[model samples]
Target: MTMSLPQQAPSPQHCLIGPLPQLFHGELAAYGAALAVADTSAPVGTALEAFLDGPQLAAALALFALRFPGAHPKALASTWSKLYFNALLVPVLAASSACGWCFPLAPGRVRFLADTDGAPLRFVLEDAGAAHPALDSAARLQPLVRNHLTLVVDALATQYRLAPRLLWNNAAVIAEETLLQCQLLMGAQPRIAADLHFLCATAQWPDQLANPLHQPTRLVANVRQRQLCCLRYRLRLDFCADCPLDCRQRQAAQRKLA
Candidate 1:
């Protein structure tokens, strides 16, 4: 008699932001290398522009906008601008990071919302909910908004093991700051902006440090199958060089020994 073995379930696959990251990393590296070789007196704006226009960064921003449909394009663009200024420009100009390779810094706000059917929807509370009557259009969109927000928070938690409090704090701070800035510059009222700001501000990164959901780490989907499932991302600072030399060098030595 022949015995049969039980079949195992197929594991779901994930796709990380691939080509974009590679492109950005390569471009930035090249620019940095060129700067290193050139006279220190060379203009800095050229290198800065190169980094900003790098294929990877542009692709990443586009991907981000597509991934979170609930976010407004203008708002997304603004967030990217802030991120570039804060994470890249600030660090590089300040000469903070080791290779001067500033990681992409995304402000902590900018989220997503989905309809009841799981389709993505854009939601922004401009002027404390007064300027945009659409935000309060109906109660029907609440669940979608909540679910989208939850998915994004959960995803981040899974990826970074970020503390809930820290995530919430960061989100609130960034959202409020961004919204307030928008209100002033665009003459936006308080209600919608404030409300929207509050929602994003209060959103906490889901607690997934203990048990994470089974999802692809690099969440890749075909063009047709892609759903705006992710919302908000922070540029991961690659501080390997700036990191304390003790542990890093020790680990290197250990690897050589092994």
Candidate 2:
């Protein structure tokens, strides 16, 4: 069974806490048109445009962000971009490609990866059982997962000028714990968020660095094409597509079963 999300919508006071939705809608529409041109047999563009204009994309992104705090903002944006483009955009562009494009017809599982530097990335696919062994140890992995997510959320709050009141209570302590956990899991001494920021800015592919506290980051994953495309971000980690960490446990279970 699929996991159920909390039914409560964002309070009116919290509505403006993250990135705006218009940015994603416009990008997805453009991407859909591009896909349509490639597939001569379908009117995928029109369908994709309509889907993007609907509420599904917004809802999906919001839910994913709320669910997975560990996902890098860039990764979340890329994941969402791919989902919107392929599942909703491409299909509407070329229905025949639906089978090929929709590797994850339903919400897939998510996994979080953090290097010694504290840069976090999320991996998502239909099954987690097929994932690397390091991803499967629930007892050992759960704390790290939680810590990564808390840090992302904290970083996002700092970047966006979002008030602490908008986040869950006790966010700072939670974030600190997360940082510690990431340090433990990676077997590296933890650096202060400020120090990590310096490292991220100098990195060759800074976008791959998960530092929502500094500026927005972008990442791309081509599940079928094996390409990595960058997605745009407004608020540091505001987009939902990049929040693969939210789906990690579920993906792990699914992959284990498979």
Candidate 3:
């Protein structure tokens, strides 16, 4: 069984916490994400590379299958990526813009925490110490995409027989949404706002490869729409309100009800 984590504890000395406690309070806390300190109370958990390897990925897929009965492998993969990005990106990007800190997300330094069912819960990672110096959007984002997310996306795509674009879309949507929220909250700080804007608006990283995150959504008519469907409806969930595949009429109706 997954033991309940101890009541909220003080962040470890080297964990990323610059302005996080204040930024994540009150109603905004619902959107907050953080890295858990590595401690005995939490299980040692699987290393990030283990997900790319055979055993841990298989176990995680089995648990996801059990968790979302009738989900196709595609939907299952999407679900996993959504959770993964939420746990990692929301906090990391927020800290980067809000406090000028960047996390060292190398696979070796990061671990994934899961419940008894092997469902991912959070990550345990250490801060990389000082922040990078005035990096452009491409340089600032390169390590995050290439060093960390790309490996995970490649693994999931190969394992699930899903397209890499779909997985990238999953991450892109989360990143786009996170940056938008950060802008709303940190708009008063020009650098923070600019960082958020450059991260969102730039199409390619330093490598000049087509950025999957580059405008993953668009303003369709008046309503915004996702560039690609996440395929979750295959699992029997409703099409995301912004899904491009869903007709504009249905989207309008849903918005009215909201």
Candidate 4:
């Protein structure tokens, strides 16, 4: 008589009953991304536009200045922008690429919460119920890039007297890093590659307008080099390892190795 093999169990599937999937819990918490809760001890957050327009921006910068004494105001704002992008983009990009879900991440719908130390505590979305499937990069991130982030970038660039390209470069780094982490965790999700290309490789957005995030970095001898300097060196007194301004030595070293 022939022996029969046992049947294998079905692979687990993700269902979006709430703001995030179980797979994303650790990643979201690491980035301080959270859904709004009724009993949160976190302070009430300001709408993104109001935060940019009101005294909230000044207060935030003041807190950042206190935290990093002697740093120039522009450098303070640039560093704060990096923190803000990290809190906002990591979860949004992870959810979008891994699960095909898009949060209504317009500035008005999002809020920034702060800890007692006045650092970013959480990025809260008011309505995760409005999420929908987005199969392409534009469908996933247009409102986020065009409506929310672009407005904030322009405001910060004007206020700080910094280059808008540098601010966009900061955002591009955050987006690229977030997608890289997601791919590492979930394997090669095609959407991640497509989104990365749309954000970094293409010079135009899906609408054919200029893509502010396009070609934010270049790869030389397998070493990634940023196209624009973020000026964090002003704060930290050292250039980032992959910084374009500081990459010549790294490139030379890599060339020797090859």
Candidate 5:
């Protein structure tokens, strides 16, 4: 079962991708407060941080469980990154583009709220999804998603201020990895991957992008204890099917058998 938008009815304000800090500030704030663990703390940072932890990552996984209902918990846990790509990242990109806004998401500017079960319910944007197109609305949408990815990563690294090379390496790696999920959710469009490569190229990412459709090279292996991603690690869940650990194991096992 694919994770298509729900068909109950589309309320402009009641969208999976709703205008935040405006349309549903109450709901956003309530959920954000849980992350901040206090109202006065920074909600945005706390919310993004949730994507990394097990309890918080559940918010991402729940989206898949809802769509592909009846899947075992372990099964859901295996592809947690897909949940982040489809539910958290893509919706923000799509919703913002539909309204013709940048909605430049930094951790502090957005809040992802979840149900009591940790399923992502909606995104609360820092600005209205109002459109003021600088270019043709149709042509500009893809760039919005690409640009948002670049901007948010910088912001996350800055917020953490951890000089470890791992953060940068992982972000570059995951950018390509997550784009695949985005393409799957978009029904396997080739352009999504193309635009993603364009963005990585335009940003001059340290990892030289060889092919937009292939794995991007990380300039340095800062992956100390790297699992290619930490999404499932929090749950002690199985490695993602394409995770580096699993990849190496498969290669080694193949060579040994030969």
Candidate 6:
């Protein structure tokens, strides 16, 4: 959704990337203690506010930026959440499916970050190579993947009391953003070896989503329409790359003289 995102200089001396497990090779306990204070019982806004009391939020934001380096956050809570969810669900699910597990995600259980400014700067699922509880059977993989992804998104939406369509819209955006990236990755020479290619794999779609919510909640639903406008154009002079044009929907009073 960010156009012309400002490039933050990567601190080669500080950034790190690797199998999340190896990255936190021996530090899970300390990491858990740091996030223990987040107020999960409060209202959405209150919870997010309390959860951010320490450096946890900043660290999480840093993790969110790992996929697309130098990505900056917007003031909108939705924006922050969308980025965070993309970081958590997209890559994590793809990574899990790449292997044979259904690694559950949470603010705590899944790998979070202390910092990402060091050597080896791409965060990946080192655990993906291993198998876990799920059957990974063709009939079950879609629900497995969908439920895992929906679990995190649902919890976040409920925790933050976000709007009804927030998670759905976010899911839409993630699908589009991911497929676009994969298309580029597909064109790489010698074939880039990556686990994140599932986003664009047709074999991954038909069963990716568990329910047929929305007009069509298939893995990459409505790819034909591309993207629904972020609706920002309704209030300002800006439109996102996939924002659907609806100039006709504008009030006659606000019509321009073009």
- lDDT per residue for candidate 4 within 92-192, as digits (tens), equals 77777777777767777777665554555555665464446545788777778999899889878987888898899888887887777777887887988
Candidate 5 residue pairs in backbone clash: 20-125
lDDT of 5 at 258: 47
Q: lDDT for model 2, please.
A: 0.29
Per-candidate clash tally = 21, 17, 0, 0, 1, 11
Q: What is the RMSD of candidate 3?
A: 5.7
C-alpha lDDT score of every prediction, in listed order:
0.29, 0.29, 0.67, 0.68, 0.41, 0.37
Using lDDT, rank the candidates from best to worst: 4, 3, 5, 6, 2, 1
lDDT of candidate 5 over 185-253, digit per residue (tens): 555544554545554444433244322212334433564233344334324334543345556764564
| CA lDDT, candidate 5, residue 107 | 50
**Roughly what TM-score does model 5 have, to 2 decimal places?**
0.41
Task: Give the TM-score of each candidate.
Answer: 0.26, 0.20, 0.81, 0.80, 0.41, 0.45
lDDT, candidate 3, 106-209, per-residue tens: 78778776545655566666543346647655556667877798888888888888889888877877787777777776676765666655555677655677
Candidate 4, residue 84: the lDDT equals: 69
- Candidate 2: list runs displaced more than 4 Å: 1-60, 96-225, 229-258
Which candidate would rank higher by TM-score, 2 or 3? 3
